[model samples]
Target: MSKLAVGLMSGTSLDGIDAALVSIDEDKKMTLIDFETLPIDHEMKAKLKDAMDIGASSNELLCSLNFELGYLFSQAVKLVCEKSHTKLSQLDFIASHGQTIFHIPDGKFKSTMQLGEPAVIAYETGVPVVSNFRSMDMAAGGQGAPLVPYFDYVNYLSDETICLLNIGGISNVTIIPKNASIDDLVAFDTGPGNMIINGLMEAFYDLPYDKDGQIAALGQVNLELLEELLSDEYIHRSPPKSTGREKYGGFFVEDLIKKSKLPKEDLIATLTKFTALAIVCNIKAFGVSKIIANGGGVYNKTLMKYISESFDGQVEIGEYPDAKEAMAFALLGYETLHKRTSNVPSATGARKHVIQGSITYPS
Candidate 1:
């Protein structure tokens, strides 16, 4: 029998929710039936950004935002179903990658948190919901990130070295050897993806993002500044480690800006160059043969060209279609629902393959 699933993704960029309506056959093949990005309101966006940064959000605020995000996720799912002419009754389940508030991977907390009450989704949609996927991996001694590699293995693996690169708020790459399962994969955060560039654009240009990286393309790169940006110790860290805004975020960029005496345009340009260089340098370090790029970053022509040129013929972009992450997340959710083990133990450093996600049944 075929199963219909709704997958929700709110990336680290704080851009919006990507809703994908997917259908999977008994054979484990996936088809993306419909997809849309639901924009978050400006007020809520500000609140989320604030909370994402290090601060004490009132317990009331945290509780309220949790349910509110859950409701919004449900609304996105409903709109996707309505627009696609699919029925809630037809859905097998909803898989939600909720808004990640804090990813405390080491030191004190040793926990990662993504919040969108699956119970709320289940209550509203009358379908089972599976969510909070990362914590499970972390519990088993893994990075609890780059969760899409299992999906990449299932759908994009070929008889060659393939690097599935996701350029979300934080960039990460998954190296898949020919016919490799999760065991043979190597994955880690490459560096800043779209998040740093987007944050800079918003702070200086009053734009949500640099459209096609036009502003960046107009500026000149200061090679020295670019080198300084790339010298961070995180880039030298070994695999099995992941990063987010907490590391390359607003404050990090602000400090970079404060330390640099270059022109504003030049600064932006250098930062964009920094992002691209980080990817290229990591590719060299990771020994990835061909990189398949996706996410909002791929839409930026300048960024794409920089990466393409950096690697020369060593890598190519977009081996798969757009919406790859959403498609893969849908697959992840499906695997989770069936009680199948989904995480890549080597990529995440999990002790064993764990059937990830908490299931919430409809009332």
Candidate 2:
């Protein structure tokens, strides 16, 4: 049997919404039919960034933005369908990795929240919507993150030990051992990915990003600051761990600025180096023979060059490199509809395999 589905993702980068239309066959093969990224407008982006702040976050605001984001995701689906020349009636379901507002993996009350109400999406799209994909994993005593490793396992399993590195706002790596089984997989956040660098670019240069690493290439890295950054406690933490803006958001970038007297380009260069070094260090520890990289960070040529020079193994781009995360959610939604356990316990440190996501029917 073959089913057409749409996958929606709004990552930590807060850049845009990525929507992917895909076809899944009985054998569980995914063929991406069409994909598009809709840039988030400045006002909405500011509101979302504000909501991430504890002091600024309010019940009424968070409540409204949830539905607002739902509508935005709905629009993304409709646009992708229109672009693909598909109809809503022809779709199976929608898998939405809604905007993550907060993620506290370690605390007395451990929980994660992603808002973009599935009911709203369902109502708008007239299709079943699967949102809140991480809560179930957290309920099972897992980190409720790096959920794409299950998709990685399904698509990238091979005879060689390979690391799948995704560099969005935060970077995470999925380590699959040679001739891997579910139990042999390991994945965790490598540290700040494009988060710090993007923040710096926006603040200092008034640019959305350091396109093609042009800014960083012009300056020299402050190796001392890089060493200090690498010594952060999170960098040394063992697996089954994850982190987000709480640790690397605006405040972190501000502190970096206050600590350094370097020029803007030098600071960016240092931060870029820090990001690549952190990922390289983590991957090197696993001793993987091959590394497959994806996410928004892969587009940074300087960062990619730094990573390539640091690692001796072959570094390659992933399949469907641009839409990898979006496609993963689509696969996860497919698994959920089939009542299959989609979470990898080894990667998430869950007690056992469990079906993830909550489904909302249009009618």
Candidate 3:
């Protein structure tokens, strides 16, 4: 049987919501039917940014944004279905990755929180929704991150060591060794992706992103700053690790600006190179055969050029590059519905595989 489902993702970039509708067959093959990205408005983006700050917002505001984001996600689903000419009644289920506000992969608590309310989506769309996909893996003694490795395993398994590099707000790579099974995979975040670059753009250029990295292309990279950034401890960390806004957020950007004496454009150019270098350094250490890049960062020409130049092997863009994460969530939902475990225990550091999300039925 073929099941039609929609996946919604709000990544660490805080840029927008990506919704993708895909058809999955009994054999677990996915065909993306349609997709859309609903950019976050300036006000909402600011609100989300504020919420991400520690001690910046109250519990009440955080509580309200949870449902507010849920409502916004419902609107995204409705608009995507309208544009795709698909009705809610025709869908099997909706899978939402929600908006991640905080992720603490290591600590005494070791918890992660993603805020959009799944019940609101279920109620508004009149469809079953599967969400909060990370907690189960965390409970099973895992990092509860880089969940898309399972998706990569299913779709990109091959006879060569291939790295699926996703550069969203935070960059993570999934390494699939030759003739790799799920247990043979290794994955982890490779420090800041567009997080720092986008932060610099908003602060100095007053833009959302560097846009094809045009700003970076206009300036020279400050080699001194590049070397300084490369020395960050996160870049040297081994696998089975993850990081987010807590490490590379606004405060980090402010600190970087204070430490650098270079011009704005030069600083951005350096940061763009930093992103590329961080990814390349990790890939080389892992001895990856080829790199298949995806996510919003792939669109930044300068960043892509830096990555391609630094990497000696083949570098290619993923199919449906922008919609990869959204589609992954949809595939997770499909797997959950079938009572299948969707998490890669090796990638997430889980003791065992388990169904990853909580299902919410329509009222």
The Cα local distance difference test for each model comes to 0.83, 0.91, 0.93
- Model 2: per-residue lDDT, tens digit, 177-239? 988898889999989999999999999988878999999999899989888999998988888
Best-performing candidate as measured by lDDT:
3
Per residue, candidate 3 scores C-alpha lDDT tens digits across 1-363 of 899999999998999999999999998899999999888999999889888898697798899999999999998898889999999999999999999999989877779989999999999999999999999999998989989998999999988899999999999999999898889999999999999999999989789999999999998998988998999999998878999999999999999888888999999999999999999998797678799999999999999999999999999999988999999999999999889999988888889999989999998
Runs in model 2 deviating more than 4 A are: none
Q: Residue 184: error of model 3 in Å?
A: 0.4
Worst 10 residues of 2 by lDDT: 106-115
Per-residue accuracy of model 1 over 1-363 as CA lDDT, tens digit each: 888998889988888888889889988898788988888878888888777766746667778889999999999899899999998999999899899887876664468878778889999999998888888888887778879888878877888787777888888888888777668888888888988888888878888888898988898999887777788888877778788978888888788767878777888888888888888787675456788888888878788878888884455566443467766777888888788989998887778888888888998
RMSD of each: 1.5, 0.8, 0.8
Provide the clashing-pair count of each candidate structure. 1, 0, 0
Misplaced by over 4 Å in model 3 are none
Instruction: Give the poorly placed runs of model 1, Cα more than 4 Å off.
Output: 314-322
Q: What's the CA error at residue 77 for candidate 1, in Å?
A: 0.3
Error of 2 at 309 (Å): 0.8
At residue 357, candidate 1 shows an lDDT of 85
Clashing pairs in 3: none
